[model samples]
Target: MSRNKGGRPPKNEGQKIKQAHLRLTEDQHKKLMQLEDQIGLNRTDLFIKRVLENQDFIITKDVLIQLAKVGAEMGKVGSNINQLAKHANTIIKNHQLPPEIVAQYNDLLGLHLVQERELYKVLRQMYRVMKN
Candidate 1:
């Protein structure tokens, strides 16, 4: 029978023998802990991924949770806006809507649509981040 050496195999790239010492404030430490919990990476691995892999830690899990809640509330507001627009259209058909009210309603609806689009874009970005 043949005997073999029992250690890690040699790496094609040079060994990672260097280390870095960094300072952290209270907020920074808290965020690092949050990232460890969310991404299942220790501080060292997180730093390595950030520095070597060029990964961006823009949104944390907690921030995404809060944003999701706000998005849900905004979704309800959007439903109400649609209902109001429908009622205004009915009033216009009956010639009961004033020109000033009609103009303001149009303006408000346009702004609401823009805001809703922005919200969806944010949600999409959050989804992409979580997926990766």
Candidate 2:
């Protein structure tokens, strides 16, 4: 029986209300109830607000694809480093090379491996930010 400022009944009341049932884990339900209390609204009102304001939600597909590509490149880099390490290990096992050469190869492998790891960390951080 709510009336608008113009003394007319609200147009929306006559509209049909749709009901839906959802299941959630106990922890999730508790969190939802806490969010409702924090927002001064029930869960239904919160869902409505979320639907209305979903423009703020981010689902960056392109960024995700780019991250996948970066991951693939990182994997290739890792594979290359792995092959190099295996080759060096084989040489060490064969003992065909001088100690100084083996030491140099080990140093080079360590540098490349560390650089690859750092690059992977950066890529992971970028992916997290984009996906969040």
Q: Runs in model 2 with CA error above 4 Å?
A: 1-65
lDDT of 2 by residue, 1-132 (tens): 995567756568647478867899999999988766654656665675566455233334555577689778868877886887788789878977677876887787789778778977876676554453
Q: Backbone clash tally for model 2?
A: 0
lDDT of 1 by residue, 6-95 (tens): 998877676677789989999998988987898676777778768876778546567768887997898898798889889988988887
lDDT of each: 0.80, 0.69
lDDT of 1 at 20: 90
Worst 10 residues of 1 by lDDT: 55-64
| Most lDDT-accurate candidate | 1
Backbone Cα, N, C clashes tallied per candidate? 0, 0
